[model samples]
Target: MKYDFIVVGHGLAGAILAETLRSRGSKVLVIDEPKENSASRVAAGLLNPVAGKRFAKSWLADAFIPAANAFYEALEARYGQQLFFHKPIYKIFSSIEEQNTWMAKSAGDNWGDYILATHTQSINQPGIDDPFGGIMIGRGGFLHVYALLDLLTEDLLKQELYLPERFDMDELQLTESGVKYKSIAADQLIFCEGYQVVHNPYFKWLPIQPTKGEVLEVQAEQNFSPECIYNKAVYVVPEGAGRFIIGATYDWRNPDEEPTPQGQEELSERFRQITSKQFKVTGHWAGIRPAVRDRRPLAGTHPKYKQLSVFNGMGSKGVLMAPYLAQRFAAALAGEEEVMPEIHIFRYLSLYYAYTDQQNQQP
Candidate 1:
């Protein structure tokens, strides 16, 4: 079989990349191991404009927010499935100082349209604490990640564009014009394997700090508002009916995606602090995020193997970053544009050189 591009891993990065390339009239074949636990699978799909304890605007929120919104909206229309939710994020202010800081920032045009409002009605309900009030961040919400992936999977399968198998690097042959995996040929091979990129020899020199995250699915005693994503020490987003997703715990040392008792307890305690509502823990999930050292996405083609490229390391912000970056990467592959410098693999060229030099020096 021959193709314009052979994409490995059907996770968020790979899915978006393949779709983008296909939209541009390229022949694409996706290779993936179907049951693998991936960050995208377990992600809450939150696309917040502001994050962290400091409540500062997220990186490139202005660019990412609009791009993601439009991209997901188009996909929803194309797929005929409701995927994107334009819910506001109500960030509960922990202190008067925090409130003051938000007041000052909201007064400026720094965040532009992303900041919907400085304050909202307190979530006046029992077991929920919010005396300090909260801020409403607009144009952000969750993407029904798995729903989109499954829709894409079905479409690809029907089109005979998907190969549901694990990709083995050993069987791959780098050819003069492209690459050959087994009997399949392609103009280029793009790796979007997420954290599994650690095992890929070609681009492992890039610093990818994979972090483990755990989240819980709980059935709250009361049905929370479906309009906004409420956050305090933990986030309790309405997942329809009486269920809410309470998560997530981040751990750098752990590599495996197996949920831990400690992770559950931590999330449970945090969930309790935010809301006094009784709930039953229905499900627990964990996955590794493909984080990078500089906290930016790692993209672009390989240094030596020009026909090989990567589109990984969007990390926890994959929902926000993937659409825009994938479009850029697909354009770069089509010889229409250049991958941005900061996220491009060239940023780590020195590391690749150092690694090759060390390899050549070895006996």
Candidate 2:
């Protein structure tokens, strides 16, 4: 098969990039291992601008949030499926000091885009306890990630552009003009293989941290409005029909995709802190996040191989950042714009050289 671009992986980054390239008139082929549990698929799809104990706005939240909203809204209009669920996040106050922190930053205020209110009574709902009151977070919600991926996958299949198979490194040949993998040829090859990029001989030198996170689906009866996502120690996000997705335990030591008893216990204990409501576990999911050392997406062409490129490592913010980064990467690939220095894969070229030197010395 012949194509303009060959993209490996069909996760969040790959799917988004495929759409972006197709929109820009590129004949792209996407090859993916369909059985792999992509990080995007297992994610709770939580979009919280003001997370963490300090409750300050997240890094680059100002830029990424609006871009995500615009991207999803546009995608929704075209696909006729509600992919982005825009809802307020009610972050439960842990102590008087936490409440005071919110008061200083935001006070029942639209004064800021992220923090809508501090110590609002709006959080007092059935099955939820808020004595100290928590801050209401705006521009916060979850994305129906699979809905977006499914639509994109179906479109790729319809166009005969979707290849379901493992991308073998041994079969790849680098040519003067492009890359040839078996019978497939393309002008450029971009790998969005998520954490699996660590296995790529060309790009393995980049520091891509893999984190295993697990989330549980629950059937709970709560009178609380499904419109708001509750964040205490753990987040309780409603999925309608009395089903809520509660998560997540971050396990860095064991970065494998398997739901563990320890992870389940940790999530359950933290959830109990949020409320005493009895709920039954319906499902458990685990995925490995393709995180970078500096917590930014990785994009750009290889230093040695100009036709080879990578777009991966969005980490916890993958869903929120993919659409924006995909556009930026597509533009960069087309020579219309340069990939942002922050995300450019060239940033790690020194490490690649150093690793090459070490390999040479070993022999």
Candidate 3:
């Protein structure tokens, strides 16, 4: 029951961290309750190089994209499962102004490499009308998140490295030697609980503005190539055969992980705008993204507990952000290198510590 590291949660963050640690010859134990609705499980796994309406290249897209692609490719080779797919994204422009904005941005130094100034291009898909036209952004695709998670879980189970239960905080004992959970003793315990980190007493003080997102699985009668992900207001990602994953409505006020009627209605309307073909709703689900106030991931050790750390707050870009940051975190944990200053949780320590200090300083 002893381990070098104890990882809480089995979402992408924790799963990737555990795999990284194990790959480095560390004895790692992953404790998770599959019942919890993790953002990773519900995510469409889209890794878009360009983000937002302005078509801004994603944060650290240059570094993170290559690392993520390499990592997923290696995983696919090791597990004999297709984990990542490299495809283009067809972003439909709404107006002439929008197209102009995209053209200007695409010409800029930052987005020049990823973005291209092109008119609507025909692909092997249902005939959908593009009024203002669309542009294709290269080096984007979807990860088979569910498939990857299943493969990781099965592999971990075969290796007898996973604990299928809710991790109890009360049972955890911290000492001078190390931390103990049940019969296991670890030098450190990292919590990658995603949005659920809001409930963690140690790291909850960090400004984690969790956002609830809802997505739908639709079966389309019209054939669309899975080679590209189409984006309008909502993304229509082909999920093999005659089905596509349509999503998602970002609700900042509502923190519930349960899909709402309003969310479904909004998403359906968006889909209707992009495609005229009929589609059947096959499934609907929701997940709360581990969004932060500044929208940057929070990663570092606990303020009071030295052996405790966190690697959450990837937000909606977990597919692009997780692997690279997880590698950085694992390296930091293994005493190999320092985590980047900007993304490190130490950047927010002053705010979090000041809040905790104010509470303790209260009369």
lDDT of 1 at 37: 59
User: In TM-score terms, which candidate is top?
Assistant: 1
Ranking by lDDT: 1, 2, 3
Question: Model 2, stretches more than 4 Å misplaced?
Answer: 105-111, 120-122
Model 1 residue runs over 4 Å out of place are: 120-126
Q: Write the per-residue lDDT of candidate 3 for residues 1-363, one digit (tens) a residue.
A: 678889998888788888888888999889999953568888899999888795777888988898899889999999887889887888888778888887786666555546554674433346565677788888888998888888999888999988899889899999886799988899889998888888887888888887899999998765545667889898888888888888788888988889888988898888888877888888899998888888788888876788898988888888898888888888988788887786788888787878788889989
lDDT tens readout by residue for model 1, 31-140: 99996457898888888878777667888777787789888888889878889887888788877888888777666647766677765445575566677778877777
Reference-based lDDT, residue 143, model 2 = 91
Residue 302 of model 2 has an lDDT of: 89
**lDDT of residue 295 for candidate 2:** 79
lDDT comparison, 1 vs 3, better candidate: 1
Q: How does candidate 2 fare on TM-score?
A: 0.94
Alpha-carbon TM-score of each model against the true structure: 0.95, 0.94, 0.94
Per-residue lDDT value at 55 in model 2:
67
| lDDT by residue (tens digit), candidate 2, 1-74 | 78899999999888888888988999999999885456888788988887588666776777778888988898
